[model samples]
Target: MLNKVFHLTENHTTVKTECIAGVTTFMTMAYILAVNPNILSAAGMDPTAVLLATCLASFLGTMCMGMMANLPFALSAGMGLNAFFAYTVVGNMGYPWQVALLAVLVEGVIFLVLSLTNVREALFNVIPISLKQAVSVGIGVYIAFIGLQNAGVVVNNDSTLVSLVSFTDHFRTSGICALLAIIGIFLTAVLYLKHVKGSILIGILGTWILGILCQLTGLYQVDAEAGYNSLIPTFAMTDFSKLGETFGQCFRVDFDGISIVNFIVVIFSFLFVDIFDTLGTLVGVCTKADMLDKDGKFAKIKPALLADSIATSAGAILGTSTTTTFVESSAGVAVGGRTGLTAVVTAVLFLVSMLFAPIFIAIPSFATAPALVIVGFLMFTTITEIKFSEKDYVKAIPAYLCILAMPLFYSISEGISIGVISYTLLHLICGRGKEVKPLMYILTVLFILKYIFL
Candidate 1:
């Protein structure tokens, strides 16, 4: 029955191989079970509730990818998008978390409609290769920057904007946390160099263990006033009833004091990042797995996108952030996963993982920071694929601006807006206007209008 459904024999893989691949994929990406709730909790959502939402959304979405798309990829609440949801939308912009979820829901619904039509593909093709690669690199840099701050390794400075942690100022609290995080980054990097699977997850646990030792030895102190949490992890059995905190919260948006134009921008911002991020993951992972056709197109692209869009909407309704295809799915493909059975196995694991929510919710930012830094390196390495081409500098300039703007400006939408507007203007100046697609022109105008008005 498995062979009949997933064509396992035809794909040259076995049930055992697929199962192992699924386990491997889950191990690598399971850090999300810990990290996502930690991130969304900053937006004032209940961490336990976010944990349940992540588990359910991952199970349903990954299962859909298996049964509908018949691919080895898995879905989860995406890292960069969650940061945007928590930090940019809720923290910086001062929007309520409920409204942020609304924007995510709208983006997901729009994405689904586009997936069912040709618009999404058309938009995908219209963006230049350099810019697409830049988007990933930008998000990588942005995530790494966030990780540094989370680890307390980077601190605010009035004169220079940012500086390293003052080891002497908070010796027993923030200082020790920063020191452990720095050590964790080195440990994780060495593991990656040695080809260790689940290196990121291991780094988190290792750092947490080290922290516990420090706590016991009087090097690390717990002081709630100093923002230092207990290094110890509580292992209480998971409470399933906490799902009520976040469930159906997306529909509870109150827009009484919200600006209509700003709301539109928020929705578009989520849509833009998610659209390209998913497409980029699909292309890169499938290409490496040799799952693409001779024309370099993913055969299951349509269904894969549908699964991603469905996951995003489901995650929002479940009271989290946008869920999308994880780039870490490449881990499964690298381990010989080639069929939906791998994804199905992964989905079951996600469902089974919900019972461990207590531990997941306890994982501190300092512990997870190493995973973000490592995953940032994984995403940032794709920067080599951008084409500058014959000193024209037209393409590279806009891509460079986009890459720098994301981390510096602290907004992915700003990077994209600058990239689109600059790309269009540069091409027109160079007599290469014809290369700019019609939709590209439209986007350029809309982005310009956004700056002028909003």
Candidate 2:
């Protein structure tokens, strides 16, 4: 039944392989179960409610990606979008969380309309093929940078903006965790080279076991205020009724004191970021998996976008930030997940997490950091497929900018923005204007206006 539905055999994969890939994918991204609540809690939300919203929304989105799109991708509350919801819109702008969720709901509806009309797909098709491959490589660096940050291997510096962790301070909590991450990186890389099945998952569990040992021996203390918690796994019954707190709150928007212009801007902000982030992740991951066709497009893209739009709208109603396709799906793709069965497994795990939230949430970021770092390398290797000739330098240069901008700017949308602008502009300047499509001209103008106004 599974094979007939997911076409597992057609994708040259087995149930065992897909299941492992799904589990690995979930393990790597399960941090959202821990993270989304904390971030949304800052927006005057119930942490427990946000956790429930996250799990349910993710289950709905990922299931859509599997059953509707038939792709090995996962969806969850986006990291940057969550921060924007809590900090920029609600905290700084002084709008209530309800109004902010309304903005997200509206944005998702807009995306749904655009996707249905093929507007989003048209925008996606205009991007040059070389730039798409560059997006893959850039996401590699971008996600790797994220892993380093999450593991405390990279720290912020007032002067330089980024620096390595000072091993001298907080040695037990910060220092040892960072060290384990570095060790995990090496361990995972070695396992990958040895061609071990489930190497990435093993790497995560191994690093987590090391952390548990540290905690058990009193080497790693529980410091909740410091963002360090007990590594030991525990089981508990979560208060399921908390789900009612956040559900359907987006519809309860109170517009009593809402500024019309500011509200529009907020919705546009969510729309712009979610559109590009979802598309960028789809293109980049497809590139790495060799899933794009000769035209450098995902064959299942319409449904994928539809699924994303559905998830976003559902997420808003569930009282979370925007939901979008996750780049961490690359971890599964890298591990040979090629069918919807992988996404289904991931979806099932998300459903199970509502019951075992604590155990899954306790799987710390440092443990999963190595898998991302390793998968980034796997994705980065596709850089060799890009053309680098003199005549293609116009394409290559923009691709290069796209690659660097992602990690440096810390936004996938920014990378796509720069890529589109530079690609179109450079081609025009090089007397290759005819090479740029009509939609390319439209996108360049739209992107330019976005920077100027929004």
Candidate 3:
């Protein structure tokens, strides 16, 4: 039955290999179970509720990917999109969390429509290879920057904009996040370099144990008042009362003046990022699994993308951010995952996470920071495939801008917008206007109008 369903024998894989790959994939991306709730908590939502929502969405989305698309990809609340929902939409823009969720729902519905049509599939031709590679690199840099900030290796400076930690004062402090981060990075890197499977998971566990030992030995003191403490794992912090309040919040979008504009921009940003992110993950992971056809196209990509879109919408309704295909799925492919059974096993693990919310939430920022950094390194590997050696600086310049602008602007949409617009203008200037697609022209105009009017 398993072979009939997942074609395990035909794909040169076994049930044991698929199961191991699924567990490995879950271990690599399980940090999201902790990170998403922590980030979304800033939006005034309950952390425990976000935890439940994250796991639930991941389980459902990944199950769909397995049953419908028969792909070995896991879906979860995306990191950058969650940060945008919290810091930009709810924090800076002053929109209610409910309305922000509404924007995610709208974006997901639009994505679903596009996926159902042939329009989304045709995007492979519309977007240039250089820009696709650039987008992946941009996301890599962005995730790494986020990891550094989360680990306290990077901090904000009023004058310099950003600065590294000063070990003089930092070492004097009992709770030294920088030290733990360095240790985590070193450990994870060493393990990965040695070809150890589940290196990220092992690193997180090792760091957590080290933190607890430091606390117990009085090397790292807990300052409860300052909210600084040792990384002790426990099941005492989960709170589910607010879960009821956030349910069905997607129906609460405001139709007022500023809100209307905010709604449009937020949805557009989520939709744009999710589309490219899923496309990149599908292409990269499937290529590694040898699931791509002779044309370099992913098999059953439409259903996979649709599953992602539906997961995003489901996540919004369940009180979280955008749920999309995780780049970390490549971790499973690396471990010989080549069938939907891998995803099925992963979905079951996610479902089990719902009962262990406090254990998941007990993971500290310093422990998981290394995983993000390492994953960023994996994604940035695509930079080698980009064509940048030619004298046609037009193509290379836009690609470089896309890579740099993301972390600089702290927004994925801005980087993509600038890259696409620059690609259009440079091509037109170089008498290569015919290469630009009608949809690209439309997107260029939409981005321009968004900048000027909203």
- The CA lDDT at 34 in model 1 is 77
Q: Which ranges in model 2 have alpha carbons more than 4 Å from their true place?
A: none
lDDT of each residue in 113-177, candidate 3, tens digit only: 99999667776446676777777777777767777787778878999999888756645242376
| Shift of residue 251 alpha carbon in model 3, Å | 4.4
| Most accurate candidate by TM-score | 2
- Candidate 1 versus the native: TM-score? 0.78
lDDT of 2 at 157: 99
- Residue-wise C-alpha lDDT for candidate 2, range 127-155, written one tens digit per residue: 88998999999999999999999999999
Show how many residue pairs clash in every candidate, following the order shown. Answer: 0, 0, 0
TM-score of 3: 0.84
| lDDT per residue as tens, model 1, 26-116 | 7656768877887999999888889889999999899999999999999999878999899999999899999999999999999999999
Error of 3 at 191 (Å): 2.5
- Assess the local accuracy of residue 351 in candidate 1 as a C-alpha lDDT between 0 and 100: 90
State how far residue 135 of model 2 sits from its true place (Å).
0.3
Query: What RMSD value applies to candidate 2?
Result: 0.9
* lDDT of every predicted structure (CA atoms): 0.82, 0.93, 0.79
**Model 3 weakest lDDT span, ten residues long:** 167-176
